[model samples]
Target: MSSSYAGQQIAFLTQHGKEQVIAPILEPALGCVIKHVTGFDTDQLGTFTRDIRRPGSQLDAARRKARIGMELSGLSLGMASEGSFDLDPFAGMFPWNIELLVLIDDRLGIEVVGMAQGPGHSSHVQASDWPAVESFAAGVGFPDHHLVLRPQDQDDTRVHKGVSDWTGLKASFEQCLAQSGNRQVFVETDLRAFANPSRMQHIEQAAQDLLKRLQSCCPECASPGYWVSERQPGLPCSVCGRPTSGYLTEVWKCGRCLHTSVQTRTDCAFAEPKHCASCNP
Candidate 1:
């Protein structure tokens, strides 16, 4: 079954070499051309170094980028990727990254999203000397991941960004330290896609997810993006034979035609006792 997107031109608005990883996975599978559009500075929407604040939520930002790419290239289809960094949701101990790839089909009047999240490299440190800076860089995977520095604290505008080499990072650290009002330099991992390999890997994963969604044709209308949209919880506990906090049915929905399909698990009909609310309680 061939996709409707085959032979179509999909505009991608990105400056940080995202096209290199995303296009390779998407183009071959979908048979669509990824038109790299780059006239606009995407940093105006947001920045990892926190120079410019992001105006809206992550989804809104991704949608805006997709719209911009579509407008610039005059294409009916467009896609964009946006990444966010924060503490991990499970423990709130380690840094975490979430990458979102949004595809907008103007002709079909629908939007599809692909997402992936995992451990990230967005961390910061304040150091008053070179030894501390070196230790922090060593822990954070610098050179390969890149580094950004500012005097005194993260809010400082006098920043040195994209320092890859150890020599450059040391020089930038010295420069920031000398200019520091309190003999301190604030350093952090650069979160840009080109600079951060870990985050870029997540972006590639999101691209693969996008490919999967785009290839999943709707059973009713034969449209792309026919994937699970909701989960219904009613799995009976294996021990108690009572409903538990587990998904029993998956509601698959199509973005284009609003087609719906419900799939129940055949592999497992009972939730573990540990997952059962009544039994565990």
Candidate 2:
């Protein structure tokens, strides 16, 4: 296989329409062509709405999706993305979206995973009427942002989704309120890449990270993808010199070879005295 992806075509497995957001970042970085695979039912693999729950970790799911795209496109290289939303992976108060991008090269037998997290606002709301719905929608960037609505009635399974227009919004709002037995309507953000600009930015960042890693070469084995796989935690307290629960070094490894390298953490050199167990306890 060639070292870089220049002039190579990569298939992207996504039925939720992710090509526009992912392509702009990946094409220039990797110098590759990105084609969307339309035949695959990516929703069947997993859904953000709780049906057909994603079967594996973000990285694993991305790899599987990438493989499917490659097989369909008859290309040796594939690229895919997966995302999840939660109450912040780092320190925060509101929910956040975490997106992962995967690049698979069958010829080289290498898988590169890049991940990024973006601020998430509540995509959900409970509204009883059009007035309430309008107010709620405004908060979630209505008209410009899409939404999915489900009736809250225990017996109602009908879901009104992909709503973006005022007409559709009014109709779905009335339908949901009537069918919900006066119960609230469950409104959530339509997390599709095209619908959410924040998610698109997250995917773009992940693609850039993947490309940066691809540009690196292992010093020992000379692999094209050489970057940190993990980090070691144990920065010493500046005064006490006792190990503290902070990043000490990053462990960089080559994707193609088993070569590894460790370098001191760039963000910090010493743990605060208050963070040290010996100094604080």
lDDT of 2 by residue, 93-122 (tens): 677988888888887778877778878644
Poorest 10 consecutive residues by lDDT, candidate 1? 1-10
TM-scores of all candidate predictions against the true structure: 0.98, 0.90
Error of 2 at 21 (Å): 2.3
Give per-residue CA lDDT, model 1, range 1-281, as digits (tens). Answer: 44788899999999999999999999888899999999999999999887899998999999999999999999999999999998999999999999999999988887889999999998899999899999999999987999999999989999898899999988899899899999989999999999999999999999999888888888888878889999999999999999887989999998888988899978799999999888788
Model 2 residue 77 lDDT score: 86
Where model 1 places Cα greater than 4 Å from the true spot, the runs are none
What's model 1's lDDT at 105? 90
- In model 1, how large is the Cα lDDT of residue 107? 84
